[model samples]
Target chain A: MGEAPLSWPDGNDRVPYWIYTDQGNYERELEKIFYGPVWNYVGLECEIPNPGDFKRTQIGDQSIIVVRDAEGGVNALVNRCAHRGVKICEQDKGSFSEIMCPYHQWTYDLKGNLQGVPFHRGVKGNGGMPADFSMADNGLDVLKVHVRNGGIFATMSDKTPPFETYMGNRILGYYDRELDGRSLSLLGHSRQRIGANWKLMLENIKDTHHASLLHVFFVTFGLFRVDNDSRVEMDDTGLHTALSSIRGKQELNDGTAQMRSFDSNLALNDPSLLDVVREFDGDQTVVMQTLWPNVILQQQSNTLATRQIVPKGPNSFELHWTFFGYEDDDEEMTARRLRQANLMGPAGLVSMDDGQILERTQEGILAHPNEQGVVELGGRGTDDADHMVTEVALRAFYKGYRNVMGL
Target chain B: MTITPELRSEIADLANAYALAIDDGELDRWPRFFASDCLYKIIAKENFDSGLPLGLLMCDSQGMLQDRMEAFSKLNVFGPRSWRHMLGAVYTTGSEKEISARTNFVIFETLAGKDTHILCAGEYRDIIIREHGALKFRERLCVYDTTMIPNSIVRPI
Candidate 1:
């Protein structure tokens, strides 16, 4: 068998299918994107609020442990045991005074320092270390941790810029608007394994054109119509984007007629599902923001949630959704958010179509590996667009992706 | 009051009917198995046990259930699949006015040319009441053991 020729198109407008299907590219992404100068979302600081509370998570394929120290500071450490490289913590979340390896009982403090070695000095001075093994030298690999508005982020690279500098003022403004000084309470969690490449999932989140076309529930129920006032904004680097739309009275226009889901007679028996309580004080009913690598902050109506995309392999990824509400929310406000939660999830009414669509998309591309996907709907560049029905966000993603992978 | 075999059989039949209705793609008939003001939710057992109120599908009223059925039938796009619901031993207590029953269930899925796979396994904690001369569910909580849902769950389990 001969080796297949690999080629990348000239610009961000064309994406080769092999990127999603090639094993070599996936491995390269793990190093260049995941392990490079990028701040990865680990978990929420509120998740480990109390002292000694910890949660196990991942950055790329490397397992990580996020815990609260005795001084109420958050720390992130590699979950591998320094001796034999065994996983130190196996449970998802717990409260522990110290992280003790169940295999050989190599104890580590919450800061991931090697505290004790069970058989050190050979238990009877027979077969342990030769008197020169320092416990301080065997501490677990720890990553730099940063927390902003209760959101925890970590990076393996010391060269990565500060969190604020990396996000820029525009993206930081959006984050502050959603979760600036407000305290968060975890309402629940839902995990879904999407049968597509991880990038495809992120692209779907950045896509605003598909909302009115693929998701009939969104347009039919008057949540977001094609004629609604909307825009797609991106940061100066084009690595981050937010597709925002405000609810307006539905009216028939050229754009509405072009959509396949523009049915005026469709009605919902339970209209309360579409009720917006105006919690954010902004008129935007939907705001889907995606950070470069894998973090998404969504404000759909009054429902607030953050999604972290973790790649399982080249062909699949796991989406971890953490739904939240304000700490000062009354019973009625919380109930409203909970009720609106039905609009987004693995089985969400307006968002469930994405899972199947992405799967089928990967399947379609796999059938023709030599072909390229045309992302020229908005234009041939990664600049910000003023209309929602544009593919500029996808172009922006490819731009950032190529910049990182050097493809 | 002591539970009678007649009431037990009636409740079992109601459970079976609900399962068959969903499995047979008669989703329009799903709302008929519940009362007007009812709660039907499919939640992870971990969340349910931890007092987390999140659910895969949370319908607070029969109207919401009807809306879900309509959306699944008319709006959602998914592959061709069929569900097979298997019910375990059902235990019922309480009087005829308001009966409580607990039973286990395993739902299997057969996609278009694929082998049948277990979709979800859970226990149903139901509150049944007599309404309009028939037993109906006032609240049905489907607590699943599987936390990570495969792809998407478009159908009721």
Candidate 2:
């Protein structure tokens, strides 16, 4: 595989379409990028708190089983059986003494060690064990699993940098802020299949410039303001960057009234829903931290979640979103979390439009490769840029992508 | 354990009518099955008693339920389908203002060319209100036995 003459835009400049709608590039991505020496988010530590508790997950299209072994250590391994390449585990999540394959009743322990097989000694010794067959040698393939502040991450290639080095101080600090001495409880899930490249979705989030415009629902309902200012940071590591504090029109005076749409205003007809409680006295931020290729950590307003993008193909991808809150949250706070959950997923009022928008973006890119998607926004003159609600974050993302993918 | 003939017949008819209204896409007429100012929620039983406020569907008031109906009719996009509700049992607890009833429901959906199959199987916990010479639902909680949802749950269960 030959490397492309790749470079990140200085600021707001156009980007190549191969990053979005190329099947060959997408396949290369799965090999040299996703399953490469990059840290991939598998699950959270709180997901399987108990020793025997486990959650089935996938890392770069490889079906994996994330479990807490008898010693309360997190372990991630390929769910495939060594015998017939059948998936060893079937259920989504549960606590089990052993992962037993329903196909032939072959059993394996929580550590993914092949324990027993059905009828090892057949009648009259007709079918016994091979001379070289060993259960210890045929255990499930385990990857390098690591955790930071209850967040679990796995890397297929053991050659990748340590987990802390991969996430860097900025990301680790962000996780510390949210998971602040609190355990997460699985609230529920919302899944949607978008008709676009998975890369488009990730790039879309990193592109904060399009937020106020594409998601008019945010600005129209006064939920998120467009008439605000922010800065984008291009980290020295190239892989790490942050979209800084977003400032919005906090107060309006004079004859300049708010713009309210019929659907937006009419949908939330309940006055209580609009009731003015205490304001959120925290940093009004929309930080998008991308961990190389597959992981996207989003802190959009009050609703926060990690979106693990698994590309089904060049044109399609399955995004699995898991929403959680601290276990110590009061009943009222939990209710507020639930209400805010409607702001992100496919059914979310603010985000339901993203799937369609991404599809359209992919379609346009597929139609025209040379017509580059411009990323020139915050980077006006300076080589280094500040975080702004624009394409600056995306410019930073692709810079990292090029460096890692060697494209 | 044993269902009374009179109550069973009435409940069976009511359940059938409710399913008919919803499956026929008559969401506006569907509210007739419940009283005004009701609590309509669809939660997995795994999360019911655990204090998880979130649900696949949660509507606290009749207005919210209507808002959901409005969303489905105007905004929601999904394949067309008809459904059959196989309802069983009616355990009732009567009070002055309302009656609490428990019933099991198995919903079967038949899409365009697909054969009818079970979409959801759950138990409904309903609070029936009798006020001003009228009987309606004050609260209806569809607590699912299984948490694995097939695809999109576009309509009220």
Candidate 3:
């Protein structure tokens, strides 16, 4: 498979199906993209607010442990043990004094410094090392950590640019708009394993064109309509994008339009389910910002969530959704967020179609591995679009993907 | 007040009727087993134990449940499937005004071309009450143990 010459089309708009089904390409992605010069979301800093609090997550398949030291600084370390390649911490999240390997009693400090060994010296003077072992040299591999608005990011490569620089001003401004200096309280978490390439999940999120078409709940309930005032903004590098739509009612008088079902008479039995409290200062009722590689920050109505995409293999990925709200939210506000949470997870009313659609995409593509997918909704380029009905974001994703994967 | 054998039988029938309504694709009738103002939530057992106010499906009123049924029937796109619910012994306490019943359940799902698999295993903490001379659930909290849901849980368990 490696001998086969793989190349993207001339305009980088046509994506080959083999990219989603090839094991060789998947391994190359792990090496070039996940372990390369790119920042990956480890966990939330608020998740480990107090000293000794820790959470175990993953960067691709590599296990990572993010903990708060005694000095209140965050640290992210590879979960692999130095002596033997075994995971030190197994639990998802906990508060611990030290990280100890379950296989052997090799212990490390909260900062991932090797602190102790079960039998460094000869226990009974029968057999021991030459006594020249240095604990500092045996510490767990630690990655450069960065925290912005309580979101923790880490990269294994030193060549990776600063987190803010990588995100650029436009993307950083978007994050600031939502999470600037505000503490996030973990509302809940839900995980869904999608049977498709990880890129497909990211594409599904950035495809703003499908919001009203595929998810009838969005149009039928007036959450979003095609005629609504909306825009898709992307950074200069086309690595990130922010798609938003202001709240608007569906237009029923558009009789000349081909799609008349957009004005369906179906209505929510309980209109309170579609109620909006206008938490944000603008008319933007829906905001979805996708950071290149694998992070999505979403504000759908009052429900706020951050999604971390972890690729399992060529044909599967796991999405970790951490639902959150402001730390200063009152009871009614929190309830509104919880009620609106029904709009976006594995069981979300408007978003559940994504899972099935992604699966069917993978299944369909596997049938014709040599075929190319044509993505020309708005045009064959990666630029910001003035309208929401466009596939420019998908093209932008493929552009960044080609750059990272060095295709 | 003591729960007599006749009352227990009626409660069991109510539970069976509710399960059958969902399993037999009679989603329109599923909301009829609940009171007008009911709380129906499907939460992971971890969240329920930790007192986290989150649920996969959190419906505070019968209206929301009816909306969900309508959405599943009209709008959602999912493969052909069937659900079978098995309930264990129901332990009841409290009076007729508000009876607290705890029962174990295991739901098996059979997809279009796949074998039947254990979709969920959980316990239901129900608050049953007498409304309109019938036993109906005022609060039905389905707390399941599986945290990582498979594909998508489109239907109610």
- For each candidate, what's the DockQ? 0.78, 0.17, 0.74
The DockQ-based CAPRI class assigned to model 3 is medium
lDDT for position B49 in model 2? 61
Each candidate structure's TM-score, on Cα atoms with residue i matched to residue i, is: 0.97, 0.77, 0.96
Report the C-alpha lDDT of model 2 over A108-128, residue by residue, as the tens digit. Answer: 888878899777766587886
* Per-model CA lDDT versus the true structure: 0.85, 0.66, 0.84
For every candidate, give the share of true A-B contacts it also has.
Answer: 0.69, 0.06, 0.63
Q: Judge candidate 3 at residue A257 and give its lDDT.
A: 46
Residues B29-107, candidate 2, lDDT per residue (tens digit)? 8666777677777776656765555565666666666656765565543557787777886777665355678889888
lDDT per residue as tens, model 1, A197-300: 99998888777788888988887665776577887888766778888888765566787788777787877788888777776767788888898787899898
Candidate 2 vs candidate 3, DockQ winner? 3
Ranking by lDDT: 1, 3, 2
Worst 10 residues of 2 chain A by lDDT: A253-262
| Interface CA RMSD, all predictions | 1.0, 4.3, 1.0
Q: For residue A290, what is the lDDT in candidate 1?
A: 93
Badly placed stretches (over 4 Å) of model 3 are A1-5, A253-257, A260-263
- Name model 2 segments beyond 4 Å from true: A1-12, A117-127, A229-231, A234-241, A244-282, A285-288, A299-302, A363-371, A379-388, B1-36, B42-53, B62-137, B140-157
